[model samples]
Target: MMQFHDAAKTNRSSGKVARPRLLAAATWAGTVLVLSACGGGGGGDAAPAASAQVPVTLGTAGPGDAQNHLPLAVGHSWQFEGTITEGANSSPTSTTVTIPSTRDVGGATALVLRESVVAGGQTTVIEEALVKDANGVAVLAAADDVLSKALVPYWELRFPLTAGAPFVQLDKTGLDFGEDLDGDGRNELVSLYSSVQVVGVESVTVPFGTFPTAVHVRRVLELTVRRSSDGLAFDATETGDAWFAPSVGWVQRKSELVGMGEKLSSLERLTAYTPGSLGSAGASQGATSTTGSTLATEPAWRRVLRASASAR
Candidate 1:
């Protein structure tokens, strides 16, 4: 039997009220948009020599903490090939997420990130900022408008990761989305719930190479959008899995959404990546930053495209 965790709608941060609530789908709510693209690649691609080593062996897939397992550096970039699956239809997808630069926000030095998705002869790009302090990595607001207040910053990854450990990322959060749908010139209310956990360590092989000690993480997102004015309601749920290698960043990811009266899925396999120096690259800098950040907190909503690049 499949066990479904009761995703609660509690605020994970300080409780503050916004004059007008906004829908997060435009930004962070995107974590669940693509899930059903299906394809298969059983071939192995050659990768560069193992010149890189896991700096901190705290959780050597053996003993250590996962706080530093993910490396985010400025100028760091990764391109992924995704496949989306619908009832008898499948399509290929390509996307890239990069840290453009770094900036100061609320006393925390954050990284500027942009993710571009191309599929179905169209392109959609989303930009967000994030920072990893003692609390973990969180996505910030793009502007100073009601968004920063209406929508809470989305947390991409959490810390102290241990095998078989579980934690809720976002509580049952309810807010009114400022976007107008149905061409009725009215915003709708969206209820959101999400959570992530470190499943364990495993050896996974991808186009990049074989990682013997990759951390397996899983996430689930559920939302309900309601328009009290027109009596419209939609319910959706998205689940995702990702493998992260220490010193390296995200090696691969898979996501699926099975609600909202539709099926959408996506897979992100690292095709090519250059983990630059680890701070957070904002602009063009010759030096590499010393930390890690994600390309898109939400790369959902798009057709799937497939392409492979020779491993470097």
Candidate 2:
């Protein structure tokens, strides 16, 4: 997986330009764009109305409550189409996030959301492996690019949430990050600092449809990378914004790195969503794939991207 905050095109002393990639971060490290932020005026289009009813409440919540109106349940899934733009080139990809199953984490049952993205003729997971429990939602581990080994966990968010509230950051800095960047056995150290802030209710338009009363969340991260092969280190910052609809989870998000001169940005928007059917009350279990999976596997995304990639 690429770093949601990785450099667009690194300038190598040996005259090599790194490939442009739209990646994911253990924590989102981005700077907010002039794009539609909550409470901003003259946005050209009127913000959508608050029609998306909250699956849960919109205000303060406790441990067992759904934070930011996010509905976490087995079988629940969201499909998104991602467009990553660098300079004048852009790459479109598809992703599906589903709660494959549950496991014991921190002594509590955690809903594991598997995020699979197909790129470069391969389907790979983000490696963060989102898990939710009574405490709240947690984003664990770095991407395969950052930590091919040691998993760095972050208790991203806790309950008792409210508008204009500060986020609960689990891990501020991670060290000794291991990943094979150039297929070499040795790489570098990746350290990160992440924070998320709620900007209250707002409306946003996405591919799926128009969502009203979308909970806007902003995330910022600072990454310090140290090379093991050489005594070299660099720091970069990133920012991203996500809109979550009640009961619908995340509807859209825009991610980009700070100080990037070009249009090196990635936009992901929801295309479809379905509530959990496996274990939710009043909802009968739906038919699953032969593998007992709720959503179509990687082959689906592969076909879509391949067809389009071939067309181009």
Candidate 3:
């Protein structure tokens, strides 16, 4: 099993908070808001190659940290095709999605565009959430303590199962990470945040070869804390796995939430990265000053349309 650190006691140069008191009240939380629509790609229609690279590494370090970093440029766009399973009781839902360039949104670390089944045909939408940081930038920062505090008993179990594996930043709230599967000395920690914690390390066997595993610890903070044995509390934890790339962070990831007498999972396969046109079009702006007010009220489907166009 993975060893979890005291989330409330870890380092905090990055504004890490005590385990959120009510994160468990939320079924899902993480990431940013607002992103221009993209167009093109997949098959012969793949969008033109982006001018720069998109950062896709994983870990709890700063951008400069070689372990977890991203090459994703400001105006880059990419496609994501996967399945969304609401729960074991529900049928698996397949989705073909994309994330718009990060160059035009506010407080956005990442944008997700998803299209899935609706009443009749399909629905496309964008999840424009916000990534809160001390500096207020949409950028990702690591806060091990905050995350550990949130994920409890369940995390203790899950963390041990899939240590050192890549997992998605369920929410654009900030941060992502990918492990360096290969031992070539390249840092592949993709993204990270204050709510998620990486505790211990493990080695597991896979189809590729032996890999160093990363124990991902996560839990939902209950609105009200129930006292457990001693002084500990009873909280829910969700665990998952991720595989590191050679030089890149995580080339693929699969995550799940198993707690509160239930389990949920999401799998993502990331291939390439590209810098979008906005980065080239507006060279003066930084990620923090983008115009993302549209995210506050816009529906997700509209964002999907925008991302589809941007890809083109």
Best by TM-score: 1
Q: What is the Cα root-mean-square deviation between model 2 and the actual structure?
A: 13.8
Whole-model lDDT values for every prediction = 0.50, 0.47, 0.28
Give the TM-scores of the predictions, in the order they appear: 0.67, 0.61, 0.36
Ranking by lDDT: 1, 2, 3
Alpha-carbon RMSD to native, per candidate: 14.5, 13.8, 18.7
lDDT of 2 at 164: 75
Model 3, global lDDT: 0.28
- lDDT of candidate 1 at residue 276, scale 0 to 100: 66
Where is the poorest 10-residue window by lDDT in model 3?
Answer: 33-42
lDDT of 2 by residue, 70-157 (tens): 6766688889898766667788878787765554433434455577765446675632344555555554433333232232354455
| Strongest candidate by lDDT | 1
So what's the TM-score on candidate 3?
0.36
Clashes of each: 42, 9, 70
- Residue-wise lDDT of candidate 3 within 233-268, one digit each (tens)? 212233344444322223344544333344445655
